[model samples]
Target: MNIEDIKQRITGFSNELYPFAHALIPEELQAQQLVIDGISFLFADKDCKTRLFDLLEVTEHEFVNKEFFDLKKVSIKVIYALAKKRFTQLESGLDINQFGVFYRLGLSARAALFLKYKFGFDADEVSEILSLSRIEVMTLTHESRSHMVDFIRPVQEGLQQ
Candidate 1:
């Protein structure tokens, strides 16, 4: 499907997941605008609608649990992770592909950890929930430390609102 279609699907999924005021703009108009802007920023040359669709599909699969209804919290974490990685990559002159993979993995790992912590899961339970081996879980936990700081500090700030 096209970017507009993908965005509409995301909006529908978001609406199902959380209670929020609808945008003043018409849904399709807003979706189209978002698609256009996102493409301009992220994938200027080639069509990114398909990539966005893939990302959203993965995110939807990962976040379907009722515990993730807090979209604001999830969004803050994601933004913080992306920003942190971007800044670090700039400073270190890291390969963009590596930076992107780390950022995405960090976000997913953080979300899984948040679910485990908030939901009070045992080790076995956490492993099962995340579909990760113990070694992978440990590695993710270690790698996620800096990202967690980035992800959580903003959420704490937002809580003051």
Candidate 2:
């Protein structure tokens, strides 16, 4: 493959990965660093795609096991996961925290919604990235909506009473 082709691929991947990494890690510098590392790794390996996938698998397992939750570590993990996948389309939405709806949700629920709604990833993609089952991703999405309802219900009740 042409070196230019590889550079283009890395750029596209960074766009797809950056928002999710920033959102999940809540540290912009750390998130950016991870993406940089991913790009560097991509350039260094001939079989970059496979290498990225292997890194993602390791990251996913660590996330699921709750073994690496530090912002920098999680940022690196998420970047590797994002690099491994290819997103065919690009979409945009406000950040999850910016929407003021996800603050009280659990991390899993927030990540599920962010990947699904914000990034337009399907159940399978989100499942792979987060190392959750499709069912788990679905459940997380549903629970996030439920949590939003719960958060708003009291205001509705107050207004009615």
Candidate 3:
């Protein structure tokens, strides 16, 4: 695809990826740069789209256990997952955005959780993108959920009072 098409596709998912980038990188400029760099890297991969299509063509899969499927959603999720890693590597220090429980986890755990929950990717897809095992993704996702619940409990208790 042409650069414009690639840019357009990235922009289509900017709503989700931008916040993710911001959270991971801390500095606004570096985060934006990371996103740009990520897009470049993704386009450079060239075979990314082909790999995604190959995944779709599978009947008995090595990853996901679900029967339901959607190509558009999966495509977007795959892109987001890949970009999230690129953005994350731009982290230089602990000056991360401390606005969420996700920050409490390690980088990989946070990325896995964000891809699965915020970006709506399956555990298998997240594993493929992040290079983690399915079990690792599952564990991170569970931890993320638990952390969120723990973080919200105080607020919930106060509201009940």
Most lDDT-accurate candidate: 3
- Between candidates 1 and 2, the lDDT winner: 2
What is candidate 1's lDDT per residue for 85-141, written digit by digit as tens?
444444345333443333444434644454445544455544554557767766666
lDDT of 2 by residue, 45-106 (tens): 56644544444446355452342122223343456465333211111222445646664565
Model 3: lowest-lDDT 10 consecutive positions: 62-71
Model 1: per-residue Cα lDDT at residue 146: 60
Error of 1 at 160 (Å): 27
Better by TM-score, candidate 3 or 1: 3
Clash pairs, candidate 2, are none
Give candidate 3's whole-model lDDT. Answer: 0.58
Q: Name every residue pair that clashes in candidate 1.
A: none
lDDT of 1: 0.41
Clashes of each: 0, 0, 0
Which ranking of candidates, highest TM-score first? 3, 2, 1
Q: For model 1, give the 10-residue run with minimal summed lDDT.
A: 17-26
List the global CA lDDT of all models. Answer: 0.41, 0.58, 0.58
Over 4 Å off in model 1, which ranges?
1-107, 150-161
Leading candidate by TM-score: 3
Every model's TM-score: 0.28, 0.58, 0.59
Candidate 3 lDDT over residue span 1-161, tens digit each: 24454345456554545666655545577556655555455445556555434444555643322321333344434445654665456555554456456666665676777677776878888887667799988987797778867876766556774
Runs in model 3 with CA error above 4 Å?
Answer: 1-7, 10-16, 46-93, 155-161
